[model samples]
Target: MDKKQFVDEVRSIAEGYFERGEFFCSEAVVKTINDVLDKPFDENVTKLASGFPVGIGKSGCVCGAISGGVMALGMVYGREHGQAMQEKMFPMSADLHDHIKGIYKSTCCRVMTRNFEFASPERKAHCIKITGEVAAYIAEKLYDEKVINK
Candidate 1:
């Protein structure tokens, strides 16, 4: 599949999961990516990302989507020790970071969540949008890196 097609599919999955209350932002993105990739990581460790949502326990330090994207990248390219792996991990993480930054103008959950009415339906809708798009973006990057086939 092409990037556009892959993204569209994953976005649907992520958005649906969020809408159904199956998972929050970070979990939704990670689960969508892993599911699409045929479950590369152990399910037990998948919960490691749960702490990232609400910007690290609702402190809003970093966007949960951004954190989830980075974790997904690590799941593919990480290694115990190797410069080659480091090359992939660091650059791709930064690339994901840059993409989110460019989109929201900031990677902080608080900042990205700004400009919307607090506790409003629209705010929730925007978060759902982010949850999907961020998953799609990570999936696209993995495909582009040839780490996974489309």
Candidate 2:
């Protein structure tokens, strides 16, 4: 597949996971990125994203999708004990944050979904779209960085 196709596929997969109720926004992003990257981390790594859905257990702080994207970035750029942090880590994370904030005007879940009633179909759809966007963004960044080949 070409780069665009691969990114779109990543987005679709994440959206499907959320739409099917198999996972929430954060879980879907992490799970899809892990899968697309050929499972660099264990499948169970998705559990790490579970608390981020609905903005950190529904406190509505950051958007779960963006939070997931940051975690996905960490999966790629994060360091272990005694290792220096990857130079790209902080910049890439900030880039993802800016990208999402540029589109939504805020990264706060409550702010983004304020127009929709919680639990309504509209809200669900919005979240699913954001989840897919986040996944696609990560995929594109990875491809551009040559972290993943087409």
Best by TM-score: 2
State every prediction's TM-score relative to the real structure: 0.90, 0.98
lDDT of 1 by residue, 48-96 (tens): 8889987998898898877887887777777766446667788888888
Model 2, TM vs. native = 0.98
What TM-score, to 2 decimals, does candidate 1 have?
0.90
RMSD of 2: 0.6
Question: What local lDDT score does residue 19 receive in model 1, on the 0 to 100 scale?
Answer: 78
Q: How much lDDT does each candidate structure score?
A: 0.82, 0.95
Error at 66, model 2, angstroms: 1.0
